[model samples]
Target chain A: MAKLTMTVNGRTLSADAEGRTLLSDFLRGGLGLTGTHVGCDTSQCGACVVHVDGQAVKSCSMLAHEAAGSTITTIEGMANADGSLSTLQQAFQDHHGLQCGFCTPGMVMSAAALLAENPKPTEAEVRHHLEGNICRCTGYHNIVKAVLAASGQDVSGVGIAAE
Target chain B: MYAFDFVKPGTLAEASEALSHDGALPLAGGQTLIAAMKQRLNAPEKLVSLTGIPELKGVCAGDGGVTIGAATTHAAVAAQAAAYYPALAALAGQIGDPAVRNRGTIGGSLANNDPAACYPSAVLASGATIVTNTREIAADDFFQGMFTTALHDGEIITSVKFPVPQKAAYAKFQQPASRFALTGVFVAKFADGVRVAVTGASESGVFRWTEAEAALTANFSAAALDGLSVPADGMIGDLHGTPEYRAHLVKVMTKRAVVAAG
Candidate 1:
């Protein structure tokens, strides 16, 4: 087993992971960070998206040991101090960005990464950036609305009514 | 996936030695390797990750071309190669996705030699050099066939050197499901002549469309390729498309690439 050391959600965590341990499995099972969901277990779905060193990456496609010494941010870390929802999270809630919410963590993480890089993403840019992220519910209308709204874009006629 | 041991060697020598052992596979980015392992497609006894070696992760421009470190992420190439090789950067930017591009490396893509991969077309069209730890292999002699390369056991790709062309562009017709190329064409024009490489359509992997190249070399324009067409005899055929369809696409994509290059 390799001793994987990394800072996750602003906290340094250590875990003993095997060579076959995926970063998604390591985060959920080893460190108990269940916020990073594994919807597909395959790399195609972005449900396992997380920020490694400020860049969005699919955790399922990365080995835990390879991510040693890096700073990781999950959906859990994407909140303001005192555990309140950040602007992005609030935008999701206000925009009805989720229905079952199974894909919320990954969606939120991916959106945060997108806004970080391109803070003023357009509707097409937001949709293109989220090509890897898949949502089974809500038809992704509100999800796109949430991301665009979070980017401070006016989403008045963005998608079907958020209701 | 079968259980395996993992190692992250800090240098090329150590990584090579680690991979020299039986059932040890070098992992770069693990975008494809990890996914394959999970599917029980490739279960090695050990994984030697190349990410730990700092020297294998960067980009530099000189010698009339661009040199990209093997482990440099596609995101890095997209951001770094923009000013030097805009077409290459554009291709890199559209690979897989924002997240996949963040983890997938140019070396890993080239080494795996995925038929639908974008880098092979770019590298071949640009006449790049694949630099391994021991020797530099020309792009023409590097790719062998589907999921195959000239790289031998324990050999590691250190970087790829891409010669900048006077004009270049890549046009990819991608499958919606996998986002891989249905038929991608890269057209590159150099001082000597023009090179046209087509990927995702050939059964033999990425190969130059020599007929298209000759026509474009004589006159670098989409009009030059009016009568030129790829033969469907050896093209890949699957549910995505038939061999004839892929062959037709090769010609179409080449023309689109030429127009874009202009």
Candidate 2:
């Protein structure tokens, strides 16, 4: 076992996990942050996506011990301190970006990270950026629209309903 | 994943010592090793992660060439193109996705030496040098076979030295599901010679297309590769494509890459 100390969702978290414990397993099993799903144990699926040191990564592919000193952010960290939805979260709801919500958390986190880096991305850029995050629902049409909407644009013509 | 002992060595010496141990695996990005472990394919007893060794991560430009630290992420290499190596920068940008690029290290990818990997083609075409702790291996001799490399136990790749090319291009037909190249070709022209490498085709791993290289050496033109036929005997055959299909793709991609390089 190894001792891990890091900040998660702005809280300084600490734990002792086995070397084989994946970051996703540690977050979901130990800290009870089950919002990060595990669609495929392989790195192919982005359902376990999270921010490590402010960069998006697949937590399943990383060991919890490797993330000892990193600052991690998950879907639970996106809301305001008062529990209100974030701008991106609201845009998802407004544009119907989600269907079954299985891939929502990962999609939202990836989109949030993209907008944080490049606030304004073209439709093609958005599609390319979100390629890792697979959504079986909504076919990603509205998700792309939600990202554009959060960037302060109306993407209704891009097959998404405008708020 | 099977239970394993993990150690983060702070120095290359310490990491090397750990790697020298029996059944020890050096972990770079964990993009491939960890996934294989989770699937119960490889269960190493000890995992020595090299992330703590800062010396293994950076891009240095000198003497008309660029030496990239083995641990350098694809995103870092891709983002630093205009100031360093432009052709390499472009190749790194097209690997996997942003998340994979951020975590996947160049050394890890090359060390894994997946037949369909993108970097092997680029490195081979550019005639890069693989710098190991013990010795340097030329690109032509580095990759031995699928998921196999020339790296001996206790020998860790420190960096890859690439000679700056006059012109280079990588063209690949990516497997839509995995984003790995179903057929990829990298063409590069240097001061003295033109090298062309084809990856994601042969079961024997990356191999130089002598016909394409000879043609390009004589005349670096798309028309140069028009009549050459890559042999289908040793190419990989799988669900994505057949050996003959991959052979055809090697020529098509080579022509496109030559045109792109020009």
Best by lDDT: 1
Model 2 chain A worst lDDT run, 10 consecutive residues:
A154-163
Candidate 2, residue B135: Cα displacement in angstroms equals 1.6
- Going through the candidates in order, their DockQ values are 0.88, 0.85
Query: For candidate 2, lDDT tens digit of each residue in A1-163?
Result: 7678889999988878999999999999878899999888787779889999999999988999999888999999999889999999999898889988988888888898899989999999999999899988787888899899899876756754343
Minimum summed lDDT over a 10-residue window in model 2 chain B is located at B79-88
User: What does the lDDT come to for candidate 1?
Assistant: 0.92
Pairing residues by index, what is the TM-score of model 1? Answer: 0.98
- Candidate 1 per-residue C-alpha lDDT over B1-262 given as tens digits, one digit per residue, 9 for 90 to 100: 8899988999998998999899999999888888898889998988899988998999899989899999999999999999999999999997898899999999999999999999999999999999999999999999999999999988999999999999999999999877899999999999999998999999899999999999999999999999977789989999999999999999999989999999
The stretch of ten residues in a row with the least summed lDDT in candidate 1 chain A is: A154-163
Task: List the candidate 1 regions with Cα displacement exceeding 4 Å.
Answer: A159-162
TM-score, structure 2 vs. true: 0.97
| DockQ, structure candidate 2 | 0.85
Top candidate when judged by DockQ against the true structure = 1
